[model samples]
Target: MSKLKNIFVFFGPPGSGKGTLAWLCVKRLGFVQLSTGSLFRRHINEQTDIGKQIDFTIRSGKLVEDSVVSKIVTEWLENAAHEHSSIILDGYPRTKNQAETLSQFLSEKFSSVKVCIVRLQISDEKLVERLGKRVVCAEKSCQKVYSLIENSSHKPKQTGTCDICVGKLIQRKDDAPEAVKKRLAVYHSHENELIDFYGENGVTIEDFNAADLVERIFEKFLCRFGFSIR
Candidate 1:
């Protein structure tokens, strides 16, 4: 049998640029990105039964059931699209139970699974500011990321418009100040659970600043992957 490969698990706040980093992992490093949020959104767009259930849970502002989520992800893993790909899991295994589910699944299916968890550390104050000022392209097909914060490279030349498609930039509902606070609260409540779980299970867990530029973080994480990849 082929040797098992290391899987990546990303932990961070919503606006901490985890998605951007995941994209870099896929584009530059040949890792397939698996984002549960995007998975839910895509299913909802397709109007499948699982998608509608997820849509209802999201509309009610509650986390999806752990078993359901794990099953959905497992199904995705077994799909032909990512059958032979290295995976970078974004926004998954939120609770201890969920993490356990993943562990059990890996053991049963792959014999052994190695994981490295990268936690993007950002202060609550910075998270609030970044999320609140965030805007994305209104065109679904060309949804590009942009920020009003001056430090961002994606900052538009004209402001409030996507540079690529000339589409209006829309702030996501979850980017509202109150919504951001709620998300931070949820993260804090369960953050230690995942951290402790990984540590006890002998998985490598590293924390890096989410406030850094994506390019800088990308460069740093590439080094982290160096020792593991080959």
Candidate 2:
């Protein structure tokens, strides 16, 4: 039998540091990071068929169907399997049904795929503050992220240039306060049920406050995965 692989699912409210932490983990552990949001954004920017479909759904204020999302995720997993690498899934399996589907799919594909679900707990006020200051690069290949409020950590050198790619940074339409609030509502409505599904499946669910230092949170996650940070 093939060795078991690690699969991490990051759960959090909008503006929670899930994306940041996922990137950090991927960089440190060589985990393939899969984020539905990033996938959709990339597709939409490329104007692919799937991108058009997602665009229509978003513009119409309708949720993207689970079938489409599942297909995308499954395809990615299949590709990752060929490489014999683990993955970190971000902003996926938003509902209980999706979580169940993923669990079954992974069970069949791998001898033993241990899943770890991490939830970043943060207050609504802090979330609002975080989202309001977030910015992203406009270039297709340069989607660098930055925060205006948290100038202490990192800031773009220029008004538009991305610190990573030197591409122009722009605010996404969905990042507006009104849109953020709606997204938050949708997130909270389904989060509890999703959490329960993972918990019931014996998946380790760790909750950490967003205020905790990034290094501290990373250390905890590494420890959970039997890895020690140097």
Candidate 3:
């Protein structure tokens, strides 16, 4: 089996640029990016056993059990372990229980893998401001995110259109100013608890200012891992 190197767990609230940083790592370093949301969708589309469980839970208006989510993730890691060295985990292990579960699984199965819990920090006010200006391509297959902020690197070349797919750009309902505030409130509630748990467990933790531009944030992430831009 190929030796896995690093597992980067990106912990951040919404609008903190976790996706952008993960995308950059994948593009630049050829690291495998694993997102729980994407995995859920892929499993459901393929009608896997775990997918059926997730679908049932969602349709019944209940969150999937932490054990179920962890199972699917570990299964994916087992399959991907032989091929990928560096892995970027985005939007998983949201709670302390989930984090503990993942930690145990990694220690037992992938003992040699280095885990880095990267905390992407930004003020809730700034998050609200940033998300409020966010827009995405309306095309289902080309849901590229963009921002209306003048200095954002993700601004579309043409107003109201996606630069890549030429699809109409629309603001997500969840990105509304009021909605963003609600989301941030929920995130802040348990943010410290999660941080404390990771620290207590002796996991390698790093903090980065996520309010910076995407390029700058990517550069910092690379520097943290001793990677240089190719």
In terms of lDDT, which candidate is strongest?
Answer: 3
TM-score of 1: 0.78
Cα lDDT computed for each candidate against the true fold: 0.83, 0.79, 0.87
lDDT of 2 by residue, 86-202 (tens): 688877887777888898888888747778788899887777767777789998977877877645375777766787777878878788788888888889889889887777777
TM-score ranking of the models: 3, 1, 2
Against the hidden reference, what TM-scores do the models get? 0.78, 0.73, 0.87
lDDT of 1 by residue, 1-230 (tens): 33347678988887788888889888776777777888888899999899999999989999899988998888776662335446878777888998999888887786555678989999999999988888989999999878898766778887888899899999998888999999899888788888998899988888889989887898899787673333
The ten-residue window of minimal lDDT in model 1 covers: 77-86
RMSD of each: 3.8, 4.7, 2.5
Runs with alpha carbons beyond 4 Å of true place in candidate 3: 136-144, 156-170
lDDT of 2 at 161: 76
Q: State which candidate has the highest TM-score.
A: 3
Q: State the local distance difference test value for candidate 3.
A: 0.87
Off by over 4 Å in 1: 1-4, 37-63, 78-82, 136-145, 159-173, 227-230
Off by over 4 Å in 2: 1-4, 37-62, 134-151, 155-178
